[model samples]
Target: MSLVRISHYLALCGVASRRQASRLIDSGRVTINQQLATHTERVDSLQNLDICVDGVAVLAPQDKQYWLYHKPIGIDCRLLISDPSSLIHLLPQTPRLYPAGRLDKDSRGLLLLTNDGELTQALMHPDFYHTKTYVVQVDKPLTPAFLTQMAQGVTYQGAQTRPCCIRSLSGFDEGDTFEIVLTQGLNRQIRRMCQALGYKVIDLLRTKLMDVELGCLPENTMRPVSAAELLSLTQLSELTSLS
Candidate 1:
């Protein structure tokens, strides 16, 4: 039988990050086979071990599934909840597929869902600096000064954001539309950036993540990622790794 560290096993099962798993064990929230577990403990086989975290049982995924979902505005991305409006409930039932990254309830567009924890970690890691592009509509026309401030970075929540690319797009009826590409996925970063410049975002739609695009996928629909797309994404993450 093969053995694996408890934390590593938890991460593999999409329970949490390795560090967070350690904390969970230290806090006495994890159990193995009806007994409390420790961080240094090893499980002979994940399939044979009965693991629970905070009263919720977790099982390693037998197969990894990747999906490209068009998250409609107002749907919460958190899949753990039983709310019918959550993204998870909208999609066909599968084994514990989580969002690689989050899009807020008010924002809409391309969101990735997968059961591969390693891939999720790599895609969400700050070091990879994966690009997420958004088309934002603000209540007012975007001025050169506002665009410059965004591209140069803005101070939000006591830290200056990384410099990003921003350009105006035409053909909006009521408000100005602009495309912004960001490497960091801060909470509501685009909206906060506009708010910092005295503008309110009326609509936010993620258009692309790395090579994946929302395309013409209807709202609230999902489809399996093609093999070519997954291969390209993995390559990009490796090339941009900080370690």
Candidate 2:
């Protein structure tokens, strides 16, 4: 049987994350064959091995965890604090993981959390150029001229933005809410783009990224990304990376 890193085994078994499993091993909480483990321990997932956590036998590894978190406004996605009320503080105990990209504290919606470095890298890589969708409520009822200009992507805060897809939302009260898809994500990108067009943002929420839709998942809740979605993302990423 091919042996894999024990950490990977831990991740598959749902014991913790690869990173956290390392820490647990270092802290003398993880044991293999009834002996304390080191970070270098090798484990064959299909082989006979005795694993324990804090003296309790570790059950067989489960599938890897990948989740989408519907972040609310005013909470940072990268922090973990004790206050459950704080948006940053509401995370499950697992391996060390961070959000794949930036969504300002003022913005709310789809945020990806994963321990898979390869997947995160694929999403963040500039070459991937994956499309991200946003539902933005701006100050004014959008005009044709303004929307046309936005489609061309005017330069703002330096470099010109790549051409984007825009569709106006009708029947919304007050300002217009639009569906916009962007490839390049500069800092405060949508907000800055709106400002450049003399529009003020009332609410901003990410609707989708690549094949991963924010879905109907409740606020501040998370769920694993589906296999089909993951395959699509990975395929797109690989194509771009190879090109």
The lDDT for every candidate, in the order shown, is 0.81, 0.76
Give the TM-score comparing model 1 with the true structure, all chains together. 0.87
Candidate of highest TM-score:
1
For candidate 1, write residues 1-243 as lDDT tens digits: 568888878767766546556878999999988889987798865466688988878776457778889998889986656687787677555466778889999999998887666677677778667899999988887678888999999997787899999888974444399999999988888888788889999999998988888899899888889898899877764664446
lDDT of 2 at 1: 58
Best by lDDT: 1
Tally clashes: model 2. Answer: 4
* Candidate 1 Cα misplacement greater than 4 A, ranges: 16-29, 45-47, 82-84, 171-175, 236-242
